[model samples]
Target chain A: MNLAKTALITLCLMGTTGLVHATDPNLARNLAATCANCHGTNGKSLGGIESLAGEPKQKLLQKLADYRSGEKPASVMHQIARGYTDEQLDLITTYFAAQK
Target chain B: MQNRRDFLKTAGIAAAGSSVFGIAGCAGMGKGSGGHVVVVGGGYGGATVAKYLRMWSEGQIRVTLIERNTAFVSCPVSNLVIGGLKTMADITMSYDNLKSRWGVTVITDEVRALDTAKRTLTTTNNGTITYDHVVLSPGIDFMTDSVGGLSGNEALVPHAWKAGPQTVILRTQLESMKDGGIFAIHIPKAPYRCPPGPYERACLVANYLRQAKPKSKVLVLDANGEIQSKKALFTKAFESYKGLIEYRPNNELRSVDAKTRTAELDFDKVKADVLNVIPPMRAGDIAARSGLPLINDRWVDVDWITYEAKGVPGVHVIGDALFPAPTMPKSGHMANQQGKVVAAAIINLLAGEAPNASPVVMNTCYSFVDGKNAMHVASVHQYDAIKKQPMPVAAAGGVSPAANEIEGKFAHAWAQNIWADMLA
Candidate 1:
């Protein structure tokens, strides 16, 4: 069997379609919903807080990485950034960066 | 803006659920590859899971939310309504959108029993429903025994913590109070729902009495040694109300004389025309009755990563029903995040993947100092696998430098958007 066909069957058997990303929006949305409590809805903040959306992917990723380390000074991002794996952070940053 | 609806629509993942349910010709509708998840008590946690489970699964895995009430009345900004700042309708939300837009089966009924062995739930309205996974978000119930003479007479001195009829009763009493009358509120200790809530209530009550009946005064009796949250902000707010407000910490309530409106405290006795006593709280009744192992026989004990009740594979507990760790506050925001966290874990397990262990939860509690002015305390907590508790990251949390109207606007937006996320 072809690799594409095997992947398609696996995806179909997993209860999702290829149209949705492997890291689906449901996961992204649920994960991102935590952000809405402070950063407005969907990564956008209305107050003086910096908007997480519409940032460059690399820039966002770098900022989060900085937060994960002791390099950044933050009220809560340091703790928040520590919660995700690098790949998960990649998915999150990509999710928000594409959010314009 | 990439709203949730836009995300679902773009993903072509059962965006408009109306056609999927009422009409036919939809794709696989049974249980999908992922099994069904039954959620009880559609508050902040249950509602979020019910909606997100379907959303992330693309309407594959079925979700049934059993709640006793038809509508959700949020306790987040409920103090405003008690002080006559906002109406009950302002904080009320319905599950209409959860059903119509998200394809969740919301049953308006009380869950009577959870037969974990059979994996079925016996509810008042619905006979019995089986499930693959069950999430319980029963919220808090008062420990009336902690305060004497509180068990039978709830109406006389309303708790008003649950944010509905009691809130109305308190408001009514406050309005009927004569000028120069004393309006007293007794706050429970830490580990209660909304740590900043009582202090915020004191602020609003003081604000109200100062404005409407300048002769009247508010006496805040707190059980804890100091303010549970946002100490600086609340202390400053209390100073703003000066003589109109008097705060006494460590004045634990011993008993109450409902008729005389007197509260017998450890140090002194307080008499008032209006009494709003927030009794000590424990896990909701169902959490105790579900036969789930509870910490100290009060709050449910669960694995921080999965929120699954300890020793019970399929049963998960979230919201204020779970025992609070030192770092975690029982706020609606944290409950909502726990809903998502538990959902994410369940979804992963359903997909035959490992659950996300390192879960990060954030809480932003906005307290309205008055009708328009507000203050906030924000924190980020992560599950520690070693310690098996949620811990705050170093220097990762802070309170607003001062209470202002800008945060008030954010508070409104936060409530609207969170309601939309959970219900809409």
Candidate 2:
């Protein structure tokens, strides 16, 4: 009886772990859509806008956070950034920084 | 196969944790996966940084981009849109090409805040993210207050400088004006984006009037005694386009009564049926609020060699936001080149490798004087590490084609190629 209970607990933990992992890619993709507007389809911005396709993830995240926290203060951007949560920011940073 | 699955699983967990709590993980150690990078702006400088970082790093870097708009409407060619030769859609771009072809992540969101100390970024809807490096390419902000009566009244008098609805508004006003009515175009002092943009706009508007409303004329009000960039070519074109357009030099616009459509200049007041007021500019508001070093209204003072901020460690500035050596006109081409150089430096810094002691940069500025005639200027530059600035490369390139046929053809080709290089 004791052995069966332990096995059941272990299985539940593994299943939860797999579930968490499965959701990351989708989360990242969803987050990336928000950035496609000015940056090109691939992270390149047309004309004078800069490209963010293959930058380092951490650097990208820091800058975004800075802008949101009033460390950076673009008039239009500040108004635009007020809608996100902490998790979406990470998903976006990791996804773009990981591009080839 | 199981091992591969397990590795992906681990990487996913790590990425999630890093994004949520600002943690660095081992995902970067995987085969050809350097790490994740996210960029906030998708402008010329940002796009170049993203593209080259991916190219030079191979599959080691994964790039994600976040921006607020759905399409990129270029200010560079937006004037053409106003001239009626091009449409706003013609200057717009989607991320489909960049994503499918380049393997980049594109997020269409507004970045709200950045925690540089924590290396984390947050968006209005996307949540939090941590990055190893971040590049900002948000463009200039107009100083509407520079001219009194125009303060806080974007709706009353459109600046149309950003190439979106403002461009459309300005164009519509011109289209609907009376035949023999006066259209006034104001040009500000130096250090504005696209030094030749306002002048190009004047020529295009003049061309439009020549065929549609021959009696209509354009009055150019200049803040400086002489116009900057491709002056000789523009002067010649103006002479050819005369009668349709009139030029006024050393005429600074002081105020505007938008209700009456009247503009007060330093020397005189001009009443017009239409007004296109291009205001003075500064680095976007975010740069100033962030406490980044500024030369007057600029952002991110840096050593030209490394593109590293002078006082701030690990921060860099490029594009119209930075103070480049005098004579370096702020153009998209210069911004792209600067992006590449800065990306290289960042990659080197990350790999624990030494950056090139000296870097070379190239710049080109092309102006479409009319549908057929175009002029350009190209120069190569070398960085002086000791002086921490750039000096021109001797005789590598010069102004536009010496021959007429070459100039005309090159202008067309240059426009196509530059657009391709920037977008495609």
Candidate 3:
């Protein structure tokens, strides 16, 4: 094949793989539901509440652990996180990270 | 700017299958391309080092973290879980994130031995794995023998500091005690993991009993004359609970008779239904067995500037294992900061570049005095190259106000931000 045609084919292949690897929507929805109470809808919160939307997932999990440990004080979030499991934290983090 | 360009160039070549340039760049930057880094004990420091090394190097380094369990149940927040304010599920984390996301090889096995000369680490299950670099962050090993009669028999006198089944056992014992039963918490002198940890435990446990077992009392037996950090603040908060909590200082626990549920303190023998004895500690067994030099009865010695082991070449120690500064209490916050600093040093060493010999490290410790009242201490320090030690940096950070609404809010925000920095 000609060089241009070969390059075009490679570009198309890359796009398809990129689309497949994009964030998962189902995961994002689950996280939104889990975090909505304190973090507000879509992780954007009201006054004094921190936004979790677009934040790194590792940071989210660590913050939750800190709150539960009293290393980080929480008025309500601590109680909220106390109800989550490790699997649930992963699901929540993945879901929120995928949100806009 | 030149260094960034050079790094990008090296990374670009490495990505394009130029193995020679990759090795040359890594070596030039004081890092290794293909050699493995096996970290024993995957807690805050180890996990931070492993994650950052993988992230900052962009998969160039093969990092293997050997932990005894797949999940890390953080001791920082386990108290909340015990107080019924948080659940066990909240404090637990999986190495799966570190493994799958960060490309670190997670070996869920206990480290058995370390051959520093051979550069080999043997695990209980994985046998032996050699490394070009080894990061030991095994944390503290409790010395039950320091508490006299409590030695060897942990079941009778439990120290729930490790945050596992022992934590649950301590919780169960507390739950089973009589409504007005006495709960005795013994605090170690100094150089323990999380200096504010014991006080926080006392507050949370007292908070729990005030509601669940109103008649029960919590007597804190402190080794030091005063509570280590934020003493006055915690003392005042305890008064709000009235008879539920009592603070006793200068009461060093000399021995304990578990059968009689009696503890012999410096002043007298006290009988209690529950005994929580936190003994003196040292670095993990691997550090001692490896023959690494220690400072002030601790783990491998490292120059504060570069975090390189003083006597040992090519070996670096970070976290609770190292005796950096006497005033700096061992906390996850400090360990995470040290991890980044050590990671930078490792990268520099591999590239044949001088590490940032003088890096600033920050530490923030939060202690929840009661359900709502919380106190904090945050500080920044710089390594004095000539002095070979760490000194507090001027005007960087300060402790949380003893009691104020604004300070309370700030402490809460600090916790969120710090956790985000570490895990996220």
- Against the true two-chain complex, what DockQ does each candidate achieve? 0.21, 0.02, 0.03
* DockQ order of candidates, top first: 1, 3, 2
The chain A TM-scores for the candidates, taken one by one, are: 0.74, 0.69, 0.63
Candidate 3: stretches off by over 4 Å: A1-100, B1-34, B403-424
DockQ: which candidate is best? 1
lDDT of 3 at B46: 83
- Better by TM-score, candidate 3 or 1: 1
Instruction: Please give, for residues B157-186, the per-residue lDDT of candidate 1 as tens digits.
Output: 999999788888999999999999998999
lDDT (Cα, tens digit) per residue for candidate 3, span B207-293 = 889889999999999998898877777777778778888888999999999887798999888899999998888887677877888
Assess each prediction's global lDDT (C-alpha) against the native: 0.78, 0.67, 0.69
Candidate 3 chain B, poorest ten consecutive residues by summed lDDT: B21-30
Per-residue CA lDDT of model 2 for B263-336, tens digit only, reads 99988999998888989888766567656678875555767855655666455567877766746667777777
**Stretches of model 2 off by over 4 angstroms after superposition:** A1-100, B1-33, B394-397, B401-405
Error of 2 at B189 (Å): 1.1
Number of the top lDDT candidate:
1
The ten-residue window of minimal lDDT in model 2 chain B covers B22-31
Q: Provide the lDDT at B322 for model 1.
A: 88
After superposition, candidate 1 runs with Cα above 4 Å error = A1-30, A38-90, B1-32
DockQ of model 3, rounded to 2 decimals:
0.03
